[model samples]
Target: MIAQVQKPIEEILEYLEGRDKVVLVGCGGCATVFHTGGEPEVKEMADILSRHGKEVLAAIAPPFGEFTCYAPWSSKRLSKYRQEIEECDAILMMTCGDGLQVVRESVIEGEFGLLKRIYPATNPTGHMGGGPALFKEKCQQCGECLLGKFAGICPLTQCTKGLLNGPCGGSQDGKCEADPERDCAWMLIYERLKKFGELDRLREAEPMLKDYSQMTRPRKIEVAPLVLE
Candidate 1:
């Protein structure tokens, strides 16, 4: 699930920017999982828009109790939910980043063509961190790894320099360079392996650097026709 955080009435109010029949499309998946993305917040958003003097054409979504994962996860069948979005002049997606992108792409590819303006209510975050482990900052999205061996404790994914291996020796008492409260990623990795009795795996020194293939810029993945069909 991808997410965009829209705070301050202005970010959305500005989008209304003199239009009244504004439509808000709330994502069932992102909203159900995260408290901020759900219908109460959507209602508050609608109220905010209404208070700002814009007419909220409608707020379209299933009732609050539906489970997002077990439910459909796209705008692919916007027709299933198009009327809500169509009721207004614009769309405000409360889904994660990918959901919004998928919807927008589909709308562009579909017949309802009501795409006037769009805004993300939350920043898109990947599915890795799950619910509570939400990334406070970012991963740098470095595709390299120090995780497969270190019992999944990643010095690189958690480290600031993206160090390929081992601690910089700058970590004090297992605390990280970036934050003392956070454990040094390498140290945590080391401890994890020790606990799992996989210390022998550490003797296998990893390569001097990562394979650049994964580092290739602007990656894109496409399934062949067999997968599509």
Candidate 2:
């Protein structure tokens, strides 16, 4: 899941400066799951904006399945609220950057003039696990999967120093030197490998350094179109 945290109210107010008649758009996907942009949060934002002397023209929660980051879905869902949105001076999107981009694209394609500014109200923290209490970041989306070699622990994230090979010299008593509160990532990997009798895997030559070229920016993929014979 995409983890996110609410932006400071002062930052939001600054973005909304000189703009009244605001329309609030909330996401029902990751933001909702994180309790940062659900219906209740949207209403709370409206109240705060109202108290700040800004008029809230509407607070819209996109219908289920209409994820705010899916352009086609969000575009269709937003059509019904076009009039209300057009009437507003700005839109405060209680969602991550991806959702904000989707909404902006919808507004452009829907021919709602560029006069209406779209602003993000939440900052994406990182991708995380789905459990209620599992807020810790689990993956870095580095365009590489090293779980098999590391025994499922990501040293890039779990280790304070992001050591790929093994425990640093600073590790003492299975505790991390960077942060004594956390277990050393390499130690955990060793214990896990030992339990599985796969310690020989570590005896192999160290893996090559990660190639970041695979993670080039503005990446995209396309599936070939199907044709009937």
Candidate 3:
């Protein structure tokens, strides 16, 4: 999981100095789990702004993240906040790059075409766990969730060596043969899979030099706006 932290209060104060009425926006999905920013942070921000004599119009929550499932199903959530966000001086986005970009574009044409915007917040860094908690994994951006396929473990992405099969028998007692801090990739995978009932997927025989064009590295996808008839 990625562990993202918010910027210093002084830094945010600089951007929010002039704006009296502002909207503190948070992605309840990601921002909530990442613990980077949320209503608590918003309240903290509000306190700071109020100390400096700024009136926060509202603190709005939207559903966002890699899984943008919540907002689409619950349109009423954002619909209620649209007026507040539009009329307000600014929106402090507490989300990932993707979520923030969408929020920024949500305002099509402002009165000034320059509604003061700022990403004064820090970037998100980590993986989403089973309970949707952030696990603070390194920013590998592996683009592959091999943990499931590997019997609830990840060797390719987690292992420093990027070993697909795993470390040789030299690895002892979960510790990596090469490094103590790191566990033996294959051993961990084997044990985890054995714990789970899906060990059958393990013996499926992974191919060497397989073409994964669909799962290309550093993959970027093109997204067109939704066309509603």
lDDT score at residue 192, model 3, on the 0-100 scale: 77
Model 1 per-residue lDDT at 209: 74
Top lDDT: which candidate number?
Answer: 2
TM agreement with the true structure for every prediction:
0.75, 0.88, 0.66
lDDT of 3 by residue, 56-130 (tens): 777655433432223332233545666776677766666566555554544323222435464546566555444
- Candidate 3 to truth, TM: 0.66
Model 3 CA deviation exceeding 4 Å by range: 1-3, 17-20, 62-75, 106-116, 130-149, 168-172, 177-179, 192-212, 215-229
What is candidate 3's CA lDDT for residue 98? 53
Q: Which of the two candidates, 1 or 2, achieves a greater TM-score against the reference?
A: 2
Better of 1 and 3 by TM-score: 1
Ranking by TM-score: 2, 1, 3
lDDT of 2 at 167: 74
TM-score, predicted candidate 1 vs. hidden true structure: 0.75
**Steric clashes per prediction:** 13, 0, 9
What is candidate 1's local distance difference test score? 0.62
